[model samples]
Target: MHKKQKGEAAVITLVIVMILVMVGGLFFGLPLWNRWRAGIGGEAELRQAEFNRQIATLEAKQELESAEYLNQAEVLRARGVAEANRIVADGLGGPDGYLRYLWIQGLSKGSTPQVIYIPTEAGLPVLEAGKR
Candidate 1:
């Protein structure tokens, strides 16, 4: 009877130690498992980036080509405008002469006949608003 009781006691002690080992392992291993999962996710993202690299490069190239074409078109337009201005300036004698020509043309066309009033020495118009 004594020997049987000793065997039973030994079995109970072994079971308790096994349970403690399993619990301790679970406590320490969870963080390591999560870290490994995150590493796998990062690797997947890297693979996706690698897959799209050629497409990204082609898109950038297309954008740069389009910008260059547009810039050239704008330069051509500006050159045309400048040439027209130069021709008009030469025909009119200068920019100031062109402006005076425009003023006279405006005066001739309008029916109401705009009045030109010279400013006095005080830099005010000839007629003040409240003066009789």
Candidate 2:
């Protein structure tokens, strides 16, 4: 009977050990897994936010370049128009076809008009004789 009792005691001890192992695993593993998942989620969100900022910056730069180009084109147009009128008055065949005031408006879908002008003469446009 003592042998049988000892055997039962050993079996009970094994069961308690297994239960403790399972409980310990549950206590430690879950929090670690949850922390890893949260870290991954945070990293993904940070990457997405960074990408959005880069895109916005690129878009803004493109807009600024486009505006600069438009302003330059406006200056060219003003010069071309003056040159055309001058040539027309100077008996130069009434301003060549290439000297006509021309413009390309609306480069982007939402952009404003862009005007451009090309003069007929080789040199830059000259101011009116006495107008400075």
Question: Model 1 compared with the native: what TM-score?
Answer: 0.43
Candidate 2 CA-lDDT value:
0.77
Give the per-residue lDDT of model 1 (tens digit) for 41-112. Answer: 999999999879978999999999999999999999999998987788779999988787778888888889
lDDT of each: 0.88, 0.77
Q: Which candidate is the best by TM-score?
A: 2
- Pairs that collide, model 2: none
- Cα error, residue 45 of model 1, in Å, equals 6.8
- Which residue window of length 10 is worst by lDDT in model 2? 97-106
Question: What lDDT does candidate 1 reach at residue 130?
Answer: 44
C-alpha RMSD values across all candidates: 8.0, 14.2
Stretches of model 1 off by over 4 angstroms after superposition:
1-48, 101-132
Per-structure clash totals for the candidates = 0, 0
